[model samples]
Target: MTTETPVKTSNWNVPNALTTLRIVMVPFFGYALLHDGGDSIGWRITAYVLFALAMVTDKIDGDLARKHNLVTDFGKIADPIADKAITGMAFIGLSIVGSQSGEAWYVAGGEIWWWVTILVLVREWSVTLLRLSIMKDVVIPAAQLGKIKTTAQGVALGLLSLPLVADDNAWGDTGRVIFYVSQVILAVAVGLTLWSGYEFFRDAFRQKRAARA
Candidate 1:
């Protein structure tokens, strides 16, 4: 009888490479944000562009993995870490920069609050830990609401990241208008973040109970 050789699979594939690239981009994105203290319009624009490119990689990597059956443990783990690092930096950086500026108002004629960032961080980290706790027992796939929350956060952060208008400039009025709209979107994202967190916990606990039964 002729012997058949088993197909060998490697973990280092296009999807994982892209995910690692995204992680590599995080420092560059942060540098672009902090290099000029986020005051220079050019640097701020560069940061936004880098962030957008990183976000694109997030989508492309996952799609490539699914299409090519190249998904791996490393990709699954690194992907979310990259996402949280990028998005978390965006929110924190925006809030810090806006706090420093005298004219960074949100929808309610107030500065972007740190509590918003804190709340989002708490939810994100808490859910992440929760997942790790149940990783072996249950697979908690991302829900549809989670996707919407990510999109909303991405758009809102993108708008907020741009340094298009100054308070005294002619474009200030337009920029304020856009800022208000972005804040509304951010609010929706925050709402979804909390809602999805609740769903995750609820499902996780229910699953645990069922498993114990």
Candidate 2:
């Protein structure tokens, strides 16, 4: 009698590969921005271009994973980590550049008076810690509002990386104004993110109680 080898069941297939690729792009994106040499149009354009490519990969990875039923433990965990890495790093990086270069900071329509970048970074880590605490028991599903909040954040981050100075001649003051608008949008997104985290905890606790009963 011949024995056959057993195959392991895994979500780590083609779709997951793509998701992993997207995660890998986060560091490359950061490097692109950090290495950009100047306030020149070409350099800024290159930075923005790389950022856009990374963002596109982010969307593609998720879509492919869901479409192909390739969602994995790795994908689920790593996807969010990639998102936080890219967005958080970009925001902090841009803020440092802005502060060092003396650029105005705005989120949506509001001005960020304090160290807004630091606040966002802290918030992301805090929320991640809370979610990890929940995950030790059961996986918390993403809320609809949380999805919207994330979309807003991606848009805001993309806009933040825009080379506003490149258009200073014609757009002049308009570019500065648009930058502030993007900032306000980000601030609002953060608020929504916090609210969704509260909901996640509330539901998780309820589930735990029900399980005990």
Candidate 3:
């Protein structure tokens, strides 16, 4: 019997291009979010749009890659980097905006606490690094909690990116309601981040032990 060879897909593809676009967007998204110290309603709106675009593109690229067999090593590497870069910018930019906006504003469940940002970022980056580094030796399946955490984070950050607390917000009471909702979601996201991270670490250790045995 003849052995079948695996097909190698090239790096240049639509999904990879979208991933590249996401990487390119992080800085622009940050600029928009931080425009006029994150106080400009117009800029905030722009930032939200850019963020939404990135999120949508991320979903699209992953689907396209999986459906069409366009997955590549570059796509794998760049996709997560792009995802983290943009979201990390959102977390950092919103914290800055909240701080700059004084007591009336902040995206940390109402002026996102810097500690929240710091802790979440640490967990996110550490988990990502560990996953990539040990990918070959230990294959740990993603937990559903991790997916939930990501979705919650995306929704929270998207809502928080808006000038939710601004006096000039056209959304007015509606904006306040959305802000409250986003705050609740962010709190949940933070909880999930910690919980999921713990699960990931625990599973990783288990997997490593099994691999050695």
Best by TM-score: 3
Please give the lDDT score for candidate 2: 0.67
Residues 101-125, candidate 1: write the lDDT tens digits: 6553542222357899999988998
User: How do all models score by TM-score?
Assistant: 0.88, 0.78, 0.94
TM-score of candidate 1 to 2 decimals: 0.88
For candidate 3, the TM-score is 0.94
Off by over 4 Å in 2: 1-12, 36-38, 106-114, 166-174
- The per-prediction tally of clashing pairs is 0, 7, 4
Better of 1 and 3 by lDDT: 3
Q: Which of the two, 1 or 3, has more TM-score?
A: 3
State residue 210's C-alpha deviation in candidate 2, in Å. 3.1
In candidate 3, which residue pairs get closer than 3 Å at backbone N, Cα or C atoms, i.e. clash? 106-111, 107-112, 108-111, 108-112
Tens-place lDDT digits, model 2, residues 1-213: 999986533865775676667667666666655553324445445656766776777788878877866677777677777778877767766765555555554321112334666776676777676676667576668789878988888777777666554424434678777776787788898788778767876887788787778
